[model samples]
Target: MRYVDFTSEELWKQFLPGDHLALDTIVKRHYNLLYQYGCKFTRDAALVKDCIQDLFLYLWHRRNTINETASVEHYLMKALRRRLARALSKSGSMEGIGFLEFKDVAASPDEQLIQQEQKAALADKIKKCILQLSRRQQEIIYLRFYLNASAADIADIMQLNRQSVYNLLNDALNKLRQHTGAYFKPAMALSIILLLVLSQL
Candidate 1:
């Protein structure tokens, strides 16, 4: 059926009719993204893995009741978040989740040694600066820049008003600028910052 050429919505339609291939394609395409997003909530890799499995199982069982959607990724991310939250809450150990952790950014071997060192240093500094933000601020930054999600998508994922998403993103950027040292070109600085942050993911 050339699922590669199918839009996510089309694949979703096929999945609704109990097409195992379509469901498999959807899982293969989104599993990594779901795993990464799930990690943002908890460091427990096993828990995240189990939750993702459960998410897919739930979707498969309820396929007949699922609604049409333009973005399968968004739907999956929102569902995963809710499922993880509920699991954590039930365990009464939700307090430690949601803190941002830094993964070491990889350096290109082709880059000059000095240049690589400078980038590593900058990434370390940015990681420290981001850790200073509130959990919500870190989450907003992650969704907006790292995930490249539109404000509306973020609003739906985070359950915030659309305007609130914009406001919060702006405020998070401002806080980042305030906490991080001055850069002559704010726009360029932001690009570099997001690049370094995303590299870890």
Candidate 2:
């Protein structure tokens, strides 16, 4: 059905009408993103995969009742987060699942060689600084910068007020700057660059 060229909104609309191909495309497009987000909460790959499958099954069963969202990725992320939280709580492992680990950025050999060592070092430091933040702070930073989510989308996903999301992001960025010993401008610039690099993977 050439769903590959369809926008997320179009695919979602088609799915709501019980188009199996549309649903399949939607899942394929978003599965990796949901899995990465799920990993931020828990290191158990099997558990994360199960929760994502459950989320899709639930969505398919309730397609007609589901509300349209501005961003399908955000909606799926929020749903997956809720599903994972419930599963973890049931297993009494919620406390062990909130840490966010930073992975080394992937770069082509040419790109890696072109990047300055000092800039790479600063980016690495910024990544470490992000890990030092509280769990909530790290989540907000990931959503806001890495996912390029709007404040409203973040608030919806995090179940917080829009203003709270803004405040939390501001606080997190401030902490990153302070922890890195960089001025606000440079810290922010470095963070945006590093996050963009990480998000590509």
Give all candidates' CA lDDT scores: 0.78, 0.78
| Candidate with the greatest TM-score versus the true structure | 1
TM-score of each: 0.87, 0.85
**Residue 67, model 1, lDDT:** 88
- Candidate 2's residue-wise lDDT over 1-201, tens digit each? 688999998899999979988989999999999998899888899999999999999989998899777788888998999899889988997653464555665433334423455555656666677667788877887777778888988899988899998888888777767765642355256455445346545
State in Å the error of residue 103, model 2. 5.0
Report the C-alpha lDDT of model 1 over 1-201, residue by residue, as the tens digit: 699898878899999979989989999999999999899888888989999999999999999999889799999998998888888888887753464555656644325323566666655666667776677777878887787889999889888899988887787677666766653147556666677666767
Q: Kindly give the stretch of ten consecutive residues in candidate 2 with the minimal lDDT sum.
A: 106-115
